[model samples]
Target: MSDQQKRLQMALDAAHMSIWDSRIVDGQVIDGTVSWSARGAALLGLEEKALTQAFRDFLACVHADDRARVLDVLQDGVQRHGGYDIQYRVIWPDGSEHWLAARAQVFTGASGQPERTLGIIWDITERTRQEIMIAERKELAEVTLSSIGDAVITTDPHGKTRYLNRMAEQLTGWTSQLAQGLDIWDTMPLADEQTGATLEHVAVKCLHQRQTIGTSAHTNLVTRDGRQVAIEDSAAPIWSRDGEILGAVVVFRDVSHERKLSQQLSWQATHDHLTGLINRRHFEQLVAGALHTAKEQGHVHALLYLDLDQFKIINDTCGHSAGDLLLQLLAKLLQSQMRDSDILARLGGDELGVLLPHCPMEHARQVGEQLRQSIRDFHFAWDSRSYELGVSIGMVEINQDSKSLSELLIAADQACYLAKEQGRNRIHVYQEADVMLAQRRGEMLWIARLKEAFEQQYFRLYAMPIVHLREGLESHDEVLLRIRNSKGDLILPGAFIPAAERYDMMISIDRWVIRAVCAHIQSVRDSLAPVEALVEQRRRAPALYSINLSGMSLADSGLQDYITEQFVQYAIAPEQVCFEITETAVIANLPKAQVFMHHLKALGCRFSLDDFGAGFSSFGYLKALPVDYLKIDGVFVRDIATNAINRAMVKAINEVGHVMGLKTVAEYVEDEATLAIIRELGVDYAQGHAVGNLRPLVAGLD
Candidate 1:
């Protein structure tokens, strides 16, 4: 080569490129010299002095696997009378490998004879290494995606499935091969759990934004078999290196079990766990809504507040478990009697309220009566023992003119008080006057008063003697709750108990009663020795004193504990306590009361079914109460000696009580003739103004 040509070749060699020249004659290499730049020599593993080597020797530098194929290609190129460009791997002399890309051109003589071939070689080692590394990374990513437990799927820009991992196959029951190229929505339907509507909008949004969209809970997707499966999923847009939106990739996991757990929690929040009835909070909300609707639509709605009579006795004697069963059974009964539009809610314990939308006062009356009768006729049995359940219902009709929910509730509560006062197990409608008063107040003045009164000792106790009709002697005295107004006038319990109960103040009042009764008993024991022995002998430590228990108090789970604490603090024996619960309250929250009864009985406390055979007289409930006595309702005794029905009822009750090993007491007994008739009917005790009106604890002694 000339000196200038050699220098040019040396310059190109320093630039890390290669050059070659070859002479071709009839498809045979007449002569050839291949020179490579330093980098190219390093890539091909050839020394600079070996540039004149034979073509066959140069071919040996190519990886053995690629040698034959490369040589054949070169031979074919010569035969075709041209040059070639190709990329191949070369094992260098230093045992290192490189990628080389060679390009060549053929020069022919004017006579058309193939002449010299000149080729350029370049070191492509870095590019080749980078490409291999990219390929390896892609493979690893695919493998990792497939290995995930969550289903993974990728779709093309058109939303056609392009890839699916193993989890996708397992979850959707479709193999990747079958899923690929199919529209994603068609392959797996997505829906909202609550609305049951297709998630077409979300899918469209994902496609438009080229971003991921998914939920981790409360979502549903369809599988191949058309079964809906709840799942949580997320999708993200896939992009190419150039920032082109390729499609979207999504990850999903089945959460059917988690969804079920969430549903269960929701149920617990809104429903009573024991009886599966609407809970107090939920019931209040339902009533509030009903009132709003009724007022807005100018429609009348009835609110019925109910309590089971003598339920505590059933609970105390039969055990709380039995009481619970009875309550559950009663709930079923109440539900059956009401229209589908009616909402029945347990206001905690043995108290339940029903909202009757579109119902007028007349309809409310009919429904309440029917409900009372159903309970009256119902027979509840625990173990081998059978009891009759009775309910007292008070109802108030509300129209657009009604002030508020609180006013409506107060009216209904006042009616309930009237029901209990007139005789339990009956239904009472709110009087117009009472409703007007409540509406005028708009605000609940009673609630505020009760709260203040509870703190200020505005309450007092009165004693009514429970006399033995046969001996004409006082057996024990029943303690009656009375409130004194600011003017010092005595007010009956019926005027205030409903108010206290309506505002959830009954719990406080009950606690006060306990303290008051305890103090009264202590006073009687200190002042009257004969009365103390009489009470002690009757298991009424301070004298078999009777105290009323509200339906709310019966339902309070804390009631038994409160009673226990009172006894512990006051050093009072359970046997000295006689809890007087109306027949309606006992049967209303029979289950909860039953638990309280069992606990109280365990402490030697006794119970009485007060106002028995009042408005609601359930023979089954009577049989159920763990009572030592059944107090005949005052209504039955008002004309007991003259009225045949009253006489017959009194006879039946006395007979039933005797048969059940219980004492029968008649309230409202006023004359000797009535007392004589009661005794003839096997009545055990009598209490009334006729027996001599009840007096203050101190005055009674004088």
Candidate 2:
């Protein structure tokens, strides 16, 4: 090849240029596949032989949608000697599609008319596909913005409104066409909801800083038609591939409903559903806060605990609905009688708590008297019956000397009990010094008796037989602790148990009980050891003994180990001894009680949750406590024979206990009629004075 020809070939190769020469008068191809044509044809998945028929074949290969357009361009270039640039799709024999950019210029005759066209074509499919995809993604983004719930607006780097979705138009009261070219600040103006002051321009800030900017918490969007809404919005800048801020986009939503719902939920959490008074949980929180303030800032607050006298009689005589009505009426009356600064709460059941902040002792006592008199004067008429009510108020001055809320509450409760005992419808102030409060002298005397009893072994263990109500069920006996007064007269546990539990002496009493019971059980088991066959014959079933433990003992970390050691020393089977605790006790010290019960139960000892369905009993705790029996509280069983409500309560307790795979025990079964009702209710065991009077455990042993 000549140097000139080789240089031309090199230039074509450098530019990747393809040349085509055709006679457009008859559409004849003069030369095909000359400069880079071989390589271009190869890239198109076509052979060089096809170049000979390139004019007809290539024109036919042009995508059908672009064929006529390509023909028109060629006709204008050939006839008027005009230049043309066009991009069209090409299809190979395998049905593969490609894009080609074609440029042509016509060669003119002497008369200045075009005769033939010369064109260069090259494949540009990859770049064309990329551009198409970008357009498609932009279309998708527009559709998503218009379809979503949130309002969207886009702006340019200078904060000019570029686009608005459908939601944005509805919120701003401006159509996309009218909002275009307007400054974004003018299109979307937000102000503080409370202050009515215009907020910072979020779009301008986002665009200038190339970062996202959030609206203030109370941002209220102001619209064209003077409409406003609570909106939480943010603006983020649009960045180009070179990391330049090109524009900004703002997204926002109306959060008015969410804010209202959140406020409603907050209120419900603090107030009682029925009485509309602050619930116990929220009241306790207030007390804790007040305690802290009083200690830190030397503020004085007084707490008053009031109980409706004979509330159970009224509730039992009337239905629960009547009881509720009485409580509501009483709540309203007390609310009216108190000052606005005072806080009142329904601390569950018939108990109400009052907090008087920054009040002196004299004023607090006066307020307590007013509340008491108000309740005593109020007459509640439920159904056809008019019932008179009274209140027992306990007042305590909370100061820096108060150690904790729990202790203060207990002292107040005890003082309220003293008021009720001294005579109903009265108020009593709690005095820490023993001599001042003559009403509490009884409890102090009992404390002395308990000390004397524990020291002289004046405590005796008595067993009362638990008669099996079911025909073939086994029977057991519960051990009851009785104290002997200094005068040698026996005392019931109800008289002194309170005092023992009050001073945290129950843990020591519980240890003594465990030791005594285990010793008695060991002696019985050993007496019958020589004749194993006669052991079952001695009773309807093997004798199982139960002992009661106080709530304070449940909190003893070493109680379980102490029981285990007793079992080891006495050589007695844990199955022969069962521990009984009240539901209130378990609830008070749930973590420790749970650990104690589960540990001893693992060793084959049984547990009974006594006084079930008394107090604020939650069935939710039943699944957590593993007990062998549930003793129905005597309050329900005492009148079960005549009262339908009591019967239903007992029945429900039995059914739930059976469902949980535990036996049920009925207390206060004092007559044939009551025993018949409990037997029909499917109770597993019945224990009362009628079932068997308390007999000395050692004296009863043959």
Name the top TM-score candidate. 2
Cα lDDT tens digits, model 2, 1-702, are 999978976876686656655554343232221233575565456775324344556677788998888777776666555778989898888999989887878776676655566767777899899999999999899999999999999998899999999999988888999999999878998888889998887788788777899764788889998888888889998989998888999998888877666555566568765577998889888888888888888889999889887676676566454676788888888899888989999987788999999998899998998998888788887777788888988888788888898877877776777787789789888877622454367667767787888888788888888877755546588998887666766666655776777777888988998999889877776776566747465646567899998888889888888989999999878988889998878999999999888899999999998999875454788889999989998867866776665687799989989999998999877677888898888899998766776678877331
Candidate 2 whole-model C-alpha lDDT, 0 to 1: 0.80
Per-prediction TM-score to the true structure, in the order listed: 0.55, 0.59
Candidate 1 per-residue lDDT, tens place, 1-702, comes to 999998987887686676755666565652344544444455566654434555667777889988877766666666677888878888888888878887777777887776667877787889999999999999998899889778888888888888888888878878899998998987767888888888863444577887767655667888898778898888888789999988888788888877877786577578765577888788778778877887777778888999888677686566554666788888998899989989888776688889898888887888888889999999887778788877878887777777787877777777776677677888888886866554445336677667667776677777789877666433478887776667765556655776677667888888888887776666656666886677665752244777789998999988888888888777777777889998788888998888788788878888888878754456877666678888888767756776666687789888988899988889878677888888787788888766656666545322
What ranges in model 2 sit over 4 Å off? 1-22, 26-54, 72-85, 93-96, 105-115, 118-120, 140-238, 247-261, 284-303, 357-370, 395-422, 429-702
**How many clashing residue pairs, candidate 2?**
0
Clashes of 1: 35
Stretches of candidate 1 exceeding 4 Å from the true structure = 1-39, 44-97, 100-122, 210-218, 240-243, 432-702
lDDT on C-alpha atoms for all candidate structures = 0.76, 0.80
Q: Provide the lowest-lDDT 10-residue window in model 2.
A: 27-36
RMSD of 1: 19.0
